[model samples]
Target chain A: MNAQYRHSQPGYLMILIGVILLVVAAFVWVYGLQPLEIILGAIGIFLLAFGYKLTVEIKNGFLRFWFGLGIFWKKIAIEQIVYCEPFRGVFAGWGIRFVWNGWLYNVSGMKAVTVVLKSGKKIHIGTDEPVQLIEAINSVLHGQVGVESTQMWSEVKADYLKRVEQALSVARHPRSFEILADVGNHLDRRFTELEPRQQTWENFQRIITEMGPPSEYAELVNEDKKSGRLKLTKLEMSAIGVLLVVFGVSAYFYPQMPERIVTQWGFHGQPSSYMPKPVGMFGTPVIFAVLVIALIVIPRTASVSVNIEGFRRFYGGLLIVFSIVMLAVQYQIILWNLGIKTNPNVVGIISVSAIIVWMAFRFYRARRHN
Target chain B: MNLENWQTQLRKGLLDIVVLNLLNRGPSHGYEMVQTMKRIDGLAIREGNIYPVLARLQTDGLVTSYSEPSTDGPPRKYFKLTEAGQKALEDMNKHWDQLISSLESIRKGTGL
Candidate 1:
């Protein structure tokens, strides 16, 4: 079937001027009046040729719309269109405009029908009889040609799928992947059932939001993996018990020892008067136990995602260093009790310096990695 | 929250029944049907919007299309209601009347 609708008339002023110029040119040519009339006639011909308004027609389910005797034209299948409504965005003002909504083809009047393709782009066709033009388009779309609009729907579906894929690219959590997959399926199922009004930008925005932010989702899903219970190996647990028992049994000698005992020594390898007997004997073991407990508890509570292995290594190093320091203190105290002269200043300085250097190296390496 | 949005939604839902009812009258082309629909006040439908509803109706075997000659242009395609279309129109009209009556009663604070 074929139907035609001419929305705009030809430019009357230009046509009239062209005809006058042609008549004047002919008169001059016949009577040998003036050569300038030839130039005037040529100008009129050019204006008349280009100044006519555009026309639109529907033939065989396709819309054939053109301007000024088909100088500029386009043929669109009506079935690919989703909606056709009257548009009056007058400020867009005239021929072949690219407005924010979409493309506009017009001549003079604000009368136009905006057809939204299934791909979500729009085309505004200027028409004096917008209603009639729309009716014709609707009829073609409802007929056998209507099936082709599914192509447009598929294009829209592809765009949404692409967005979902991008969101999944940075996704860290398996849960986020699952959520996005579900959203993709849901969008596919609901899309065909939606009316034109319901298929707005807001709907897509909502869907994206429902998928959640990729970065935040990743952080949340991996949060639980950051921590685990602080369990010690069987051998390590037995060693801890033995160390604590040995220190406890030695504590019983504090009452029998002299009131004053050497606890610290100066630079020279000579015994130095130190603290009260109890201070030298008990303080070292108490400090060691407290440090060990604090280290174990602190690492266990922290999120494992923020370098759990690093924390474990650091804690183990500190435990070994403190244990060695406690052993030196115990040996010194026992030697003093046996009437031996000894100074721990050299050993103390070396161990402390070694621990400081090791800690500094760990921090420097971490900084480099970051 | 726009009331116009809700109105459009309502119109979209009723469009199928309305198109079938129009075809029940006589065989007419798409443009003619749109023009007739335009006569009703506050019923804003464009010629382009009517096709999908008609296409859907035709798919359901309630309507069919044929070409007809026009006075001043190419032959226009016209839609005719099928046997199923007539039956659907009847049922739709009965349901529409019941709905309208029920809504009217609700508005008047009477029983449905």
Candidate 2:
């Protein structure tokens, strides 16, 4: 028994015109046919051959449901369907909407019969007589329990598996095929106990769903590789800020010093070398700023994965040590210009040791969970 | 700590055992098995969710299926547990009992 339902022609007319132009263009280029007449002929052929329509029919004890001039369809073994229900929704403004839930085949109405397949995936046929359609399908489905088609089941499983393997071949993840195979193994074990549907397409879909999208999985894996790397912290930022303030304070004393500033001291604690005042005062901070900025930007631009956690901790610790060294150097230059008798190198050595001791203690305390 | 994610994890953990227990009663197809699982309180097994687990069980030789004529519509592939499956179920039950006892003590706030 076959019953056909056709949606109104207005929706299809727009699509028909769109396809006709492409067909006409192809025909005109290949056969040198006149564009105007070829277009007209194309439209006629399209309407005659593949006009849009929705259909439901009973064939070979299966309720064959399809839509759109037989371009797409699904066949449900009457016994395999548990039930059919009418679904009413916008379904994203409808005319063959492939939404998250399932494929919805509707033209203009809100009413449709949702045919739930035993394996999963639903075929929604939009119809004004949803109740009647449901009754008809149910009547056919409830007629008799016939022999399950093992051969057909095998074919469906084989076809779906092939499609999945093909998609897996070019999937973004390097281990996509392995992941799918593992999932299949898991599924095989679980299904043995559960004894769920033996159908393949829905099973394959479930495997893909569980595994997640290949692109997303690949991105997460990549992110995890980078996540263990280091970054700058609040303590480092505060240390840098304090160093900048000290640099400014030292610069304030620069103008009071001689033109040729004392840069290096001899073993006898005598001024042995001189640089321009600006070089002695500002050179360290300028160099420090450039190095710090480069360090910050290098991580962002580098293609190579950096151990960020280790790098940030090391960088933060080094910044504090280096900042103190810069201040000590600036302090020595100023005191020497002011005629003070002190070894700047000794000042640097003592300050470095003190900072090192302080940092070690702090790190040790932190490690102890204090 | 997303509740839905936690529930999904819990479901995934228990699904294999649930399927095995359902098959222990009698052979049934996938859709029917999902419906039965849904009847249990707090289980939200979707129809699509059961197939891979079934595939996994079959791969492990814990269960087997055969084609049968349905009472109304087309044929159904009905699954039943193998001898290995029965033994596995026993082991699983023992483990489950141990876990339940441990959780019971923890719930009473009397033991680690």
Candidate whose lDDT is highest: 1
Most TM-score-accurate candidate: 2
- TM-score (all chains, Cα) for each model: 0.29, 0.31
lDDT at B93, model 1: 95
Instruction: Pick out the ten consecutive residues of candidate 2 chain A with the lowest summed lDDT.
Output: A220-229
- Candidate 1 residues A270-310, lDDT tens each? 45446677777787677777777787677555431222334
* lDDT against the true structure, each candidate: 0.58, 0.55
Model 2 - which docking category?
Answer: incorrect
lDDT of 2 by residue, B49-111 (tens): 565566557646678877665443334667799999999988998899999999999999777
Instruction: Give the candidate number with the greatest DockQ.
Output: 2
**DockQ values per model:** 0.01, 0.04
TM-score of chain B of each: 0.92, 0.93
For A113-220, candidate 2 gives per-residue lDDT tens digits of 766554433456666677677666766665433113222333333344344444433322222333333333333333333233544446645643543333332322
- In model 2 chain B, which range of ten residues has the least summed lDDT? B68-77
State the TM-score, rounded to 2 decimals, of chain A in model 2.
Answer: 0.36
